[model samples]
Target: MSNLNFTSGQTIPNSVIAPVSADGKVCFYVYGKTHLLADVSGYFPK
Candidate 1:
């Protein structure tokens, strides 16, 4: 898992690679107004 925290009204670019469960779901927790973007590159079997 990966964790990213940013201050209010902060704009930046970030990249993260994390594994997902068999159900293929992701979760995020935020306090205030925030925008997020995600991309899937490839997948590998366990």
Candidate 2:
């Protein structure tokens, strides 16, 4: 996501499912300040 702006005391929910490398790692970038929460219910076999 790009060009994301939020006001004070605003709440937003965003979910993303991305494939990771061999290390099971991912990266995210935001223009301004944001909070992120990730929950892994399950994973597929490698």
Candidate 3:
């Protein structure tokens, strides 16, 4: 497993989404315990 080494109060840029699911749920793979924030910008009609 790999880790995302980020500093406190740091902002990470965009990430890519692949193998999307029908339920519109996403999963993040982290190596250890950390805090996460996900913001949805828009939506697609089903």
Best by the TM-score measure: 1
lDDT of 1 by residue, 1-46 (tens): 3477777777877766676766988666566678777777776777
Best by lDDT: 1
What clash count goes with each model?
0, 0, 0
Error of 1 at 14 (Å): 1.1
Candidate 1 total steric clashes? 0
Ranking by TM-score: 1, 2, 3
lDDT of 3 at 39: 68
Task: Give the Å shift of residue 33 in candidate 3.
Answer: 2.4
Question: lDDT rank, highest first?
Answer: 1, 2, 3
Clash pairs for candidate 2: none
Better of 1 and 2 by lDDT: 1
State the weakest 10-residue window (summed lDDT) of model 3. 11-20
Candidate 3 lands at a TM-score of: 0.42
Q: All candidates' TM-scores? A: 0.57, 0.51, 0.42
- Model 2 clashes, total count: 0
Q: In model 2, where is the ten-residue run with the lowest total lDDT?
A: 1-10
User: Which candidate would rank higher by TM-score, 1 or 3?
Assistant: 1
